[model samples]
Target: MTIWHRSARFHYRFATNRPVAPATGVVVDLSLNIVGDFVSHGGFRNYNPDITRPTPHLIHSGHGTMAFGGRTWDVGPGDVFVFFPGLPVEYADDPQRPWRYRWIGLEGPLALPALASIGLTPSQPLGRIGDPATVDRLLAEALSGTVERAFPPTRHIAMAWQLVAAIAAKPPAVDVDTVVHQLATGDPAAPPSITAISRRHRIAPSTVYRRATATLGIAPKAYQLERRFDLAQRLLAGRTLPVRDVAAQCGFNDANYFARAFRRRYGVAPSQWRSGQI
Candidate 1:
């Protein structure tokens, strides 16, 4: 059910028995529980009823200003904005052209990280949706879940993920360079994989490879290998661990192979290099 509040600006839906889907690592339980369609309020600003939850808004049409942290942005159609918990939000309609928008309230332990994946963080709270129509359609589907009083709002929860994917399909603030950087550095044992990056970012493997090569002058796999060796050098020099242990630490299953690769990289065997015999 929804409450029509023309005076308050929102056709609001109360929270429901929403099912949270938690992931394996860095668990994100973000589920769509509430949504609203906001109409114009002339030029009067409306404060958020609660600042203890994460709320993301999509500007359906018109231009307006969203204020938080003593800063304001002139937002336009297709622009999406979010505010983390404990942050105040205030907005009003554009005088020349009153603005209308939609918002979804997300709650869970890992809601902030979930939003950050789509590039909406406290530091950078606003991002332009590349395909606003897709995002719009998904949100509309979720908005309809307000009337579903069933056990679990599966459709709403599913729509939330689809919406996130659609928004993430576009470059986050037009920075594929940053994505390529993330593709270069990670845990030494588990290096960056083009396949994983392609799948997660919803981009082609060739696109990732091209960006990696263009930015670092080497592919992502090469970059990860170079990074792994940098750690190996540090470990060989600083730690008393044996070459075998070092090999294992660097994700090398065979000592002989590690020695050969280390020799090729440094022009000397790892042991000799460690002993300053290079």
Candidate 2:
């Protein structure tokens, strides 16, 4: 679809895999533009109020002001915005000083939630990359012919996910210890999966595992298990609940499996351990 002005003074094009099927999470388009001396009617507007769009899209402005959501947001370098499926929105570079930007189109069941998980939504679409240079580098890589030629749609999705993660990552000065502690014991009521933790902390799974291991002397999964075990032990010691109930409280759905794990860790069954036999 032709969305920009004819004389917008920009280079707009898609990747090799311009149109892929409806996969769970895949990039349908990856384009970069250096908008300069934008035409009067060259602004971009895509209004799909009827939930017609099959995928979500995003815009990352290198610099400029664009009218969006009934207001003019000063989009500078590293500024990013998300457009949810079926949401009507318009954006364009400031005619006075046009900007360079990148756009990505993503589709899938997980696409909307993935964006939301990183604190991006239609109402609050604005975000800033922790490192502008890094974002530029990634944009360059994504736009490069080598990546488009060598990588498949899955790779594109992974790259897009990494870009989002980088934009959401904590600033460089944040303490590693603090990060480890937060991830290790952030929400006891709802223990997070590795992918959830990675998305929430804006880091890779390997990074999460390594940091947890280095700081706590245990892997993330092990740390979580230890937390559950500790809770289970406390509940067993203080409450007269059934073993199955205690297991459920500790995030375990299977009592028999919990008993085996307890035995493995404490050298006795949960009941025996609770009765001070071990």
Candidate 3:
């Protein structure tokens, strides 16, 4: 029931401020405006307490058990885990063989889907990275992004993404259905070009279109639109978040555009749709 952390939280603007960990339940807002927090501490430590992480983070460490989302694991150097936002977490380093770990946080609406496309989600977070040093090295490189004197924030963030892309398998894919599913479920706002999909997977554009239509019963673009609006409706119905957050979660970064598109799809603006205003 004790928590220990040597925190150096770097917010956006790359300010030189090392604040202690925010108390549990204090949420970190992952706005598209690009605010962030990067926490990394080297050397031996044991930390365990209920912590709700703000942004999705990748963790690599040795000699400890990570208790995440009610699952406990005896993790080693080759063990890497993802901590998505809003999940409960606890970690304890083995006193005998102490370890170090880093949290390279990811933001934006696309981050979660991109990770999920590779089979990394809160429900299934642990993975065997097999090369702890490479992961640790990437973490170190990403951490430098927090220092004001280091590289620009965007470069560091891209480096963070590079680390993520390096871990491949990386999903339950290979079948035509899976590939089609990946495309349909990718970022809703900017769907990748059909040509790019064909080139990457070595499939002819026409065949991809034919199979995708057969698999989903609709064009890929239409499938994505329906999927996006389905979630938007539920979120709007809940009324828990503002239109902006709803839009962001549904892969619409611009609230204004989200409103315009909402009207086009549902025949009502998001604000009006929430309360059934004609």
Candidate 4:
């Protein structure tokens, strides 16, 4: 069997491994991998820079926007896009109409060649497949291995091979990135400079800056700051950290500046907000 196929079974078995706590006076150490199936409401609203690859069938189901190679495309129900490795992509929820979808995460390296036969190329950006019944059947088969509890390790490996075959046979459009961009910039605290972000992601600085302004309507640095500040607000409300420390953790070099920024965004100081919450 191919390495990709072997990886699929490895991941499936790892995910299904049951954990057993140690008995009295004994410690049990096991590197158990966990896999889960879930349905989520609301839309995905962030650019995932970590662990997202141009794998076949990486995306399960959802509606959102994918920005690739200087173009932004709308994705909704019945839309599927495939990407290649090392490509920079960003996705966010539609503000006017959010999304709800089923999702699963698998870790392995087998099943690519079979998938490639279906048009999943490391060079392709986005591909669309609109067949509902086939999609459902593939999903069902994947789930069968997950739900059977004691299904043999080889069975899951086999199921993964089947899953890839099913996906490759379907028709879809692959959307590729025009240019890669910085992965993190727009958080709640401060947006880093485009030059800084671009350098980090190894793409042209201009591309990072342009995409941030054109697609997100804000600079990359500004977007990053928002995320920092957003986290600060949560920490403050939870009373987990002191004000000065919170400011530092949120990326503010000065407590006074953090306080000022906090007031401007939430209309109250962090300390006051924390006390009010209490």
Candidate 5:
């Protein structure tokens, strides 16, 4: 494999001296690119470029959006897209939030057939999988090192095949239970909002609200607050940290506001709750 590019933000590009024959399914190039927010202008228009590329490419977006094929897709994390060989297509980052993605370029007589069997085509080349993290990990493992001696060709082929299979498998829809759990235990730094969650799951906000309320017997907001307060209670009970610190840890920035919210929820100050006093 020849390294065309490498970067600390996990951008990688590679090519092989010996192309995979039409008989053996194999990957010719693979890349993991984290096009950060710093990228101001990034777009590609491919219309039978001078260079010949005899392989289909599969791209998995970790985050951000892209405009392609005469429409803009709100490509959230875990979304996948494909580009067939010799096709004319244009794509660009959503300037506001640049994308991070992994792509595998594949060559073989079975490439298009395999992709078609799974309903991925140039016209409709988007799909999702059960485990985006696992796919990302596999791509990382297959493309590790300085590209001087990355994974051997055989290993790379195997990894690429595995990824192809995963993509071909129909992914289950995001369920209401999973959304509820995410709201309850999502990252404090990036609390899950109804809009964001709905977008991530590719559903309407109203659907998320209706499903969550039907399943959990509480509005999503109320459920999230209950979980946040539960976390706050645990933090208060387990530590000697200041009330303000506990509040911040629970996703509240203002101590007074946090206290008021806590009082409304528990009928006691956070300090009093910590002290087991009603």
Candidate 6:
């Protein structure tokens, strides 16, 4: 049986240094005096608010995959994820540990232009930012509210730019195909089993299993199960079909069993979850 986890209870504080250049004027000053744990245990999807201005987001990982922008990626400790401007992102942790992270939004005239200088764009689904120390400092400061006092608005905005520049300067060696393959093979909506996937790829089951585990850090079957669970969640969110019908369509034979599994994974019954969404 899968034991589920929930997001961490964490908080942060944010304040910006005053700007010297009018071009670099601070457009927004957010204070993260306190923030609830941003990660979700069991598996949950939440929508990101629409944004017209460039905003910076911070993501800390839990023990499971975090889904955003129609892709799922593995997250471990000390990992940092950035979502820039107007894009939607959602995340959830695994059965053992829910996703735990802190994030805030900042939009101003200089944001995108600064990011562009570093090869960072607002449109990509996801990317990492900064070294571990930088990420650590940012989070610690935000959570502890130290940045509010230690840095002025100008300095803070400059720091944000530095972070973006670091991301832009990093080599683009990340394997795009590897990420796509995971989404294609692991998404529950697709429901292609290891055997079926292996055949499709013209490889042995052991080879497929080994590759997914080695590259994705997840056993193939488990990955598929996660994807299937994601599909069920989406169907439930759509509110278009009966939960029993959803269970059948998603390949679970028993609706009661499915409900139990969903609740255990999501920390709420399907009905309750749907209600809360409304």
The lDDT leader among the candidates is: 1
**What would the per-residue lDDT of candidate 3 be over residues 1-278, giving only the tens digit for each residue?**
11233444211122222222235654322211122232223233334343333233334433566676568866554445676665666765554445544454455456677667666777777654434456566555544544434444345445545566665423323566656776877766446556555534545778778888888899977887887888888888998899999988887878999899989877889988999832
The lDDT of each candidate is 0.72, 0.58, 0.57, 0.51, 0.59, 0.54
Q: For every model shown, what is its TM-score relative to the native structure?
A: 0.54, 0.44, 0.41, 0.40, 0.52, 0.43
Query: Residue-wise lDDT of candidate 5 within 19-98, one digit each (tens)?
Result: 43224663444322211111222332224333133233334433444444566444545566665665544555543334
Q: Give the TM-score (vs. native) of candidate 1.
A: 0.54
- How far is 6's C-alpha from truth in model 4 (Å)? 32
Error of 1 at 38 (Å): 1.1
Model 4 score (lDDT): 0.51
Model 2 agreement with the true structure over 11-119: per-residue lDDT tens digits: 4544433434347664444322111122233344334444333232333433344444575555544566555555555555644334555655554555666777777
Model 4 residue runs over 4 Å out of place are 1-40, 52-62, 68-71, 83-85, 103-110, 144-150, 170-278
What number of clashing residue pairs does each candidate have, in the order they appear?
Answer: 0, 0, 0, 37, 0, 16
lDDT of 1: 0.72
lDDT of 4 by residue, 28-60 (tens): 322112233323344445565554433333335
TM-score of 6: 0.43
TM-score of 5: 0.52
How large is the C-alpha RMSD of every model relative to the true structure? 20.0, 19.3, 19.5, 15.8, 8.3, 13.8
In model 1, the runs with Cα more than 4 Å from the true position are 8-17, 20-28, 151-153, 171-278
Model 4 earns a TM-score of: 0.40
lDDT tens readout by residue for model 1, 27-67: 44656767777767456467874677788887787667888
Q: After superposition, how far is residue 159 of candidate 5 from its true place, in Å?
A: 3.4
- Tell me the spans in candidate 3 whose CA falls farther than 4 Å from its real position: 1-61, 130-134, 150-153, 169-278
